[model samples]
Target: MNRTTPSTHPSSDKGHSVVAAPVTAHPLAELIAHEIRERGGWMGFERFMELALYAPGLGYYSGGRRVLGQRPQDGSDFVTAPELTPLFGEVLARQVLQALDATGTDEVWEFGAGTGALAEQLLGELGDRIQRYVIVDLSGSLRDRQHQRLLKAHPSLVHKVIWADSLPEAMSGVIVGNEVLDAMPVHLLSWDGARWQERGVALAPQGDTPHPTFAWADRPAPEGVRPPTEHPDSAYPPGTVTETHGQAEAFVATLAQRMVRGAAFFLDYGFPEAEYHLPQRHGGTLMCHHAHTADADPLAMVGDKDITAHVNFTGIALAGQEAGWEVLGYCSQGRFLTNCGLGEALARTGQASNAADIQSRVALQMLVAEHEMGELFKVIGFVKGPWFEAIGFAHGDRTHTL
Candidate 1:
């Protein structure tokens, strides 16, 4: 993936330099414009983001080019761990095994299973260890790719893997979400020196374009809208925009409630409360990805790119705790993978006969390398049943510190 530093600073993102959302002929744009007009000229950023990414057949995720791959040339906006290497899922499966044995459940429920890559690896490695594997994704457009991939990679286990449009009322197994929380719609909260505002979107004409263009609009934060982090923006300069993980936190809470006898684990790039709301990072963490290019402007992309925010681990942990799920552990991706046997996985590759053995080893480095996804991405686990130790968070746990 190609990374280029953006020209605009977070401090000015919503000011004179605020970027415009990419104008596109895509039907999703029309849909959004229609909603804005119907809503009397403004819609919450979270709702706008929901339609942009998961509006059935029109959103970027449900209808755009392949969303997961090595690079944009491969029809992907970005790369994910399972797409990077099979070794990732292989290593993660060991921890799943422990959860299954601990819970005595034979079902594995996976959310946002893009292209079913993780499912392919997990089914291959875990074999008959699982009875039923439920794959859930918001985009029905991706099920075709997932079906074909699983059919070719694991014909035998394909029968066990079923696609569900929604979660079951009850289930008993390990649940996993990798980079999934980041995709959930987030509310944009802005501090304007004196008070907070709920940032939103409105339609307006720009330049010579006859069609409507996306613009930022702000309103007083909804009643009872509490600060996302403890510190808030006590001393940060004005126009300090940030995101609140209400949707993501609600998702964890719902999953925890429905999960009767199993555990759930999520892996994403983020920080605990203190670091997440550092006074230094006055600019919020909202970001957009298009053809591997990173930008702070989500407005410009419309339905052509992926918009995401850093997962707030502290929020996730608190959500789980409120829902009565035990906070198993939290740690960087490097430490989690190491505790789950990434070091041994890499060593085994040294003696493998696969043609891509060396390539696989390199990919592993990118997954856990300190300078890469390692320190930034973290794993957080929660349990509902008799809590069995989460092998992935057995060591170097940073939960207390958070």
Candidate 2:
């Protein structure tokens, strides 16, 4: 990606230590500020977020693959499940293999293949069983890193890996996305105790503030101001801020259309429809990750960190269903992994004392623990053409919850 400009910021954000942001003003901020000026001095938060996180080479995700890792020393904002342990992918492979066997396809399409860690784990474990591994990414920035990783780590099977900037006319295989949907940009809606408005960002004058700022500004929700229909009762109190899942829902709608004969699975931390739109959650889920620290301010750093929002499984399920795809199942990561045979995998490791083995065990435990990724992270499966009882949902399918 040919980014607009470089970014420069301080090493700390709001008194908290973080990955040192550029000392000088980042070029991307200048470009975005100019963009805001051109757009009548205001840009919707969604558009701002999209540009900040996916603006070619300038976005947080479009530059490097090392941002996804398990340790703080990895120079990453946060660690995903795949970065935690090989067992994460191994157990997930069991679920994918079953889906492939059921659908009678040998291909695996992965979205947002971070660091190619999960890809390596899947390819290594699946072996000759998987004929092709297609990585579909919008940024295309990780191609070189993924290619080198595959070539060096699995020389013989490296030929099976391919990268695509766009989706094929139709797909017929197992599709997987881990911690992917949460990163999709979300629309922020605010209730000001009286009316609804859309929250957005506007550029601050060149010398108005430090760290090159984009201040929060609100306007009538574009077309006929109104809150989302997810909650028609208007039960939310004043001063409430919530998010609408248009991007995530739209992505699923498009995926359902392109996928002609296969099942897709997404793993992320989210909640069902009823729980998601709770009035108690006054603040929206918009968040930023920097050096393992979570923060709510996006104005401080332009392109120096990761920004994300929680997934609305309800919106995802509705999109898939509306597009005529079957909602196979939805369950916790722990239950899903257990149903997919995590115990068998752990037993095979045999209480090894080696560092690698010990790390794998710890990761496995974290993946299934009560208060860890186990309960918060969820797995949702969708199918288009052929269908069979997805084994991962056999234990406690929560299709009804969605």
Candidate 3:
């Protein structure tokens, strides 16, 4: 694979910027081009995303990239909550402990356990209260990293840690997924004045470039293919682009079916269906992150960056509820963490006079402050057997909104 510095170019189509660079021969690019050709020169964006992120050994997550870190200087793409500070996981552990006790389950299932930082923190805090810690991650490289980190962090309990590529046939545990649903592939739907179309990827015409260049191509959407909006299509102005979370919703439904009795929580940045498909919000939430920078062009850097879309919590709740899982609660991450005792934990850290303490204080603030991750990020919980008031959503439960 050839590596070259990327330069940003303002895109005229949408307000989002794109990484404009010379087309270089990359293995993943070639593979995708071949697939597009085999599929008659057009491939759905969802399939492209699936291959770009989770296709065996060539995808981004599985391609041995250092994806999670505090800074771009570490050759990482983005920073997650657990990576931001240990306080995040510590505060979340309270809810997990409550769920374990409430559900009478000893196992903890974590999806997309990046760097295993949260797992390590949870394992350390929960101690022997956890019988089995199962991690379901598609990235082999990340699994290796998680294994090493967990082994060193919790030597005695490492034996109880299990790594699986997919969910088991039947299981009972408290499931946790941080920034996981947003990564799942989503179908892109663009609205025109007349009708809705499915946005896809197609090979650009041959030019002086050395490798194949991909471009957006739209086709008429199938019948009933439109955003889940209460308002009529005419309400949205032309050029409105959005995503449908089929894969993510299916994931929740499947998990609800598999789990005999347990609770699950997902933390991510998203909004309800009404807010998601708003008229003024023309550009969708589809974004790409690389080296701590964000861009809108997923076609530019095939397997080098992370592609994600905002979660539609309303749809997620319906899916789970339809599949026999009761909605425990839904609220902002800031409120949930605060309700789960984040403020108390901060107090225990003492006055922020020392540099280390100050840094901890800042990280904690970012996790809860409305201007930062607190407001935009949300937490949704689900229970299979019986409904118990989750501590995280005790005070600020927004399940009514969902």
Candidate 4:
């Protein structure tokens, strides 16, 4: 079970190099290729994700390359809001307050705390309001940095920030995950009218291969889930594609079970069930990020690239229900922030007495505007306790059948 980039030659017809550049060698790529070869040159989206995100030492998130949020250096790949400013956490603090009063829990756990900036701001805003703060991430390299950041942001709450590689036993707290679900591995399925199949990556023929290429593998459809819609006649011609994700479902299940008796919020970019199952989305939403460019070649950058799938909210909701957590609210990030007082907060900042204060107002507006990250991203939360009024669902404009 070994693999390597295959060779390709210049095309006589096109007079162009048929070969793409060699993929940078990474331990994760090697390992995944080995597994695929062992299992007949194919793997499910979930398996791909398991290897990509947590394959020992070579996976994307598990690797040492720091491509999280907002602190990327010159020409770096990407950054997130948590890196933008402490104010992001300040706003989140308002939401945490709602969760606290709703769930009757005093603790807050943050997943995938990239660089720990959000935790720092959240702890600062929380102050004594929260009994404890836990930062759960796999990167130990950022632990000391997180401690230092929190110490500076909220000296009083520094000791309250704890680090754990895994969830605590019998925990009851508000769990917040920002941009976490999108990174979860997703299984890509193809609906061929009469049958469904899984997508897989396979090493091309020795002479024809230019790095590894992906192909569809005929396999049993996921149990209990049927095609999005029936396609009679020649709609697919026996080889068309559609996508679904049991992997994301399993992830939601894991989180739901871990919550046991609390609230969990998932914030990421995705469409609801209605648009997600649209007929035009036949190519599927699997994407790869390498050096800031979004493309389909997972092998283009190997260990250095990021691969993600648009979260299926319907699947997540269904899994949550199955796992025993009650779904409380489902809405876009824009509506959720508005409900959490984003408008009022911005207006207050707009009344800034000085130049510096006015600048602060502008930044917050950037986060709330519809043109920015507002409409595209969605936020969903599940609760097991008394809190019930749906926060984001108050706005019905963007609401879907989910």
Give lDDT: candidate 1, residue 379. Answer: 93
Please write out the lDDT profile of model 1 over residues 1-402, one tens digit for every residue: 512123232453332334465556777888899999999988999999999898878888877467777867777777788887899999999999998899888998889898788999999989999999998887766788899999999887899988887777877799989889989999887777767778888875667765567877777886767456667456666777777888999999989888888888899888898787776666778878877778777777588888888888999999998987998899999999999999899999978787788778888888887778888899999888787778888889999966
Clash pairs (backbone) in predicted model 4: 69-80, 70-79, 70-80, 189-242, 190-242
Candidate 4 lDDT by residue in tens digits, 1-402:
000011221111111112332554566666777788998766765686667767766777676666654323443355566564456667767877777877778899888787787787777677787888988877565566677777877787778878887765567888898877777776656555565555545544434543443333446566755544444424543434445667678867887777756788888777777677565555566666654555654545566767766777877888998987887778767678777767776777766788766756665665556676666677888888785675545664343457
- As a whole number from 0 to 100, the lDDT of residue 6 in candidate 1 is 32
Q: Scored by Cα lDDT, where does model 1 land?
A: 0.82
The numbered model that scores best in lDDT is: 3
Residue-pair clashes per prediction, in order, are: 5, 8, 0, 5
List TM-score per model, in order: 0.94, 0.90, 0.94, 0.83
TM-score of 1: 0.94
Give the true-structure RMSD of model 3: 3.9
RMSD in angstroms between candidate 2 and the native structure over all alpha carbons: 5.9
Q: List the residue pairs that clash in candidate 3.
A: none
Query: What is candidate 2's lDDT per residue for 1-402, written digit by digit as tens?
Result: 000011221111121122322333766787787788899988887888898888877788875535655556867677777777889898999889889888888899999887788899999988898889999776555667788888988999999998987888888889999888988888877776656777777755446345456666767666655544466536876656667878999999998988888899999888887787787766666777777777677665777777777778988999998987899999998999999999998887766889899888887888887677788788999988787899899998888888
Which residue pairs come into collision in candidate 2?
A: 5-27, 6-26, 6-27, 7-26, 8-22, 8-24, 8-26, 9-22
Cα-based RMSD of the predictions, in order?
Answer: 2.3, 5.9, 3.9, 6.5
Q: Which residue runs of candidate 1 sit more than 4 Å off their true CA positions?
A: 2-19, 223-226, 351-355
